[model samples]
Target: MDLSRQRCRLWKELVLVASLLALGICQASGQIDINPDSLIGVETYRTRLVLENVTSDSQQNGPMFTGRESVLKTGDLHIRGSQLNDTGNYTVRVDAINGTQRATGWLKIQELEIPGISVNATSVVEDIDSVAAICYTNDTNVMWYVNSAPVSSNNRMTISPDTKTLIIQRIERFDSPLQCSIEIIPEIFGRSELIQLTVAYGPYGMTLTSMPNHLSGVVSAEIGTPVEMKCTAYSRPESQYRWFHNGSLLSFSGENISLPSLTWDQMGSYRCVVGNSVTQLTFYQRLQVQVPWRPKPAQKRVFTVSGSYVVVLIVVTVLGGVVFCATLIYILFKHYSTRTNRLI
Candidate 1:
């Protein structure tokens, strides 16, 4: 009886060991799990596959696993090549002492497509209340750069809503050639093309004035007499005119002198100084005063009526006496002549 029991016990132990070995073989033969089946147009991407044993038996065995020469044991599989034709599907197989497992994946290579770009505006004006527009083509987003640095967020530099152009408003005189670029993707470090711009300075210095350098006039008792003085000057910065007399500035406030009052005090050398910030010029005119002449009592009148009457009386009396004598003599002569004639 003892011998028979020992044989049975030994046989049961051997069967248990065989069953465990079989289970271990099934576990090693399970499928290998790869997350993705294929990859297309990928550049420098990581590939990974999970080796899974579905059987419940836990046992270690030597397996001949096959994979691409570039594949890693734990981390992602890295694949790199210059052209698209260098891509191919990769299959990994694991073979144990009892069974085998397999996993497959594909990688497709592609070349980066960089878009063409161009800039329109070449020159810009500065220091004035003006805006400059820059146009671009065949780009995703327009980026504005000034002297190679990005422009500020201030309203002066802004991107248009359409994303096709950039506007710079109220540019300063000191601002230089504002550089600009278009970026397709920031991470990809992809750039289209380079462009340059030039900034220009000033249409400065303007001046203005009237004609006729000299002015003359006369004063009279007539009320509201109009006297006009011409104003004239020249300058580059656009001079403005202001009339002055006796160091006092004249106003165009009223009808006379274009001011409220034209009193005597307002009369003097009138000067008009024309100038701007850059240069100055001056003009001048003289004014004179006049009065009516009057006579004095000391100077006597020549030929009065009394002297004329006395001279006339004396001349009349002398002429009368001469006439009487002549008449008397004539009568006597006449009497004698008559007697003689009778005697003859």
Candidate 2:
């Protein structure tokens, strides 16, 4: 009798275990899921409530998420399109008759495809307003970036109504890298590669700042000394420098013109022409290079004075010559006379 009762209890226990197994049908899994914006589940809960991931509480709208894109179908979370700012951790929870089942996963968005990125003008003159830029693609919209920073619409830069084209008005001559990208879920969508811009401006701040007197706007070099002068300018797309003397071009290319030693023949009107090939704008700065060193005559003097001192030097020189000749003649005559008397 005891053995039959024990078998009966064992059979009841087996039945209870099977019932619990059926109730545990819904289980949570941590999987990396990719979606446009929302993630789905494995089992369908007709009346499902999102415990997380929505901007607003799902309870306020309805007992379940019935939004066309958010409907829980076949237990999958149907997330929808997203803005650039939408990103981060997202999850969903639903109550099953047996217990609560939730899928915990993160969201990631893929960037749109584009044929290419290009500007309306590859090279533009600086200070021009409203130059159109386009990101060539089937996509109706694209976000523009300058040097990796998002380009916002303003007076100088305006986005078109469709957002595919960007207009840059009042373009400065500063060269910058431009890119067109899309906004994704977690971060900025991958941008279309291959877009760079060049802005051409005049040779800016062109001046010869190396010569000793260059600060005074004059280029002066000392004769018989090494000469190095620089004609420098700040510009975009780099300015090509040309050095000229007496209206003739030098055979060198660079900001600096150097000579091992300067001479009087090298003294002339030295000019530096700074030109920007992109803009075809040129600027010129001219100054006379004067060598103040002069050759002195063989005459020696303790002090080199000018004006009335010249007369004093002349008088002293003549008096010294007269005294010297007289002294020599008297000495020669006395010697000759003394010798004649001795011979007689």
lDDT winner: 2
Clashes of each: 7, 12
RMSD of 2: 18.6
Model 1, 1-344: lDDT tens per residue? Answer: 12112111111111111223444333343455545665554333333333344333232222322222233333234343334443555554444455555566655554444434444455544443444545445555656655556665476766676565556666554444454555433344233344444444322332222121222333322223334444444333344556567667776421123313345554445555444443233434333322222466687669756877888988888888889889999999999999999999
Measured against the true structure, the TM-scores of the candidates, in listed sequence, are 0.32, 0.49
The residue ranges of model 2 lying beyond 4 angstroms of the native Cα positions read: 1-116, 135-142, 173-175, 184-190, 211-215, 219-222, 251-253, 293-344
Candidate 2 — what's its lDDT? 0.59
- In order, the Cα lDDT scores of the candidates are 0.44, 0.59
lDDT of 1 at 98: 55
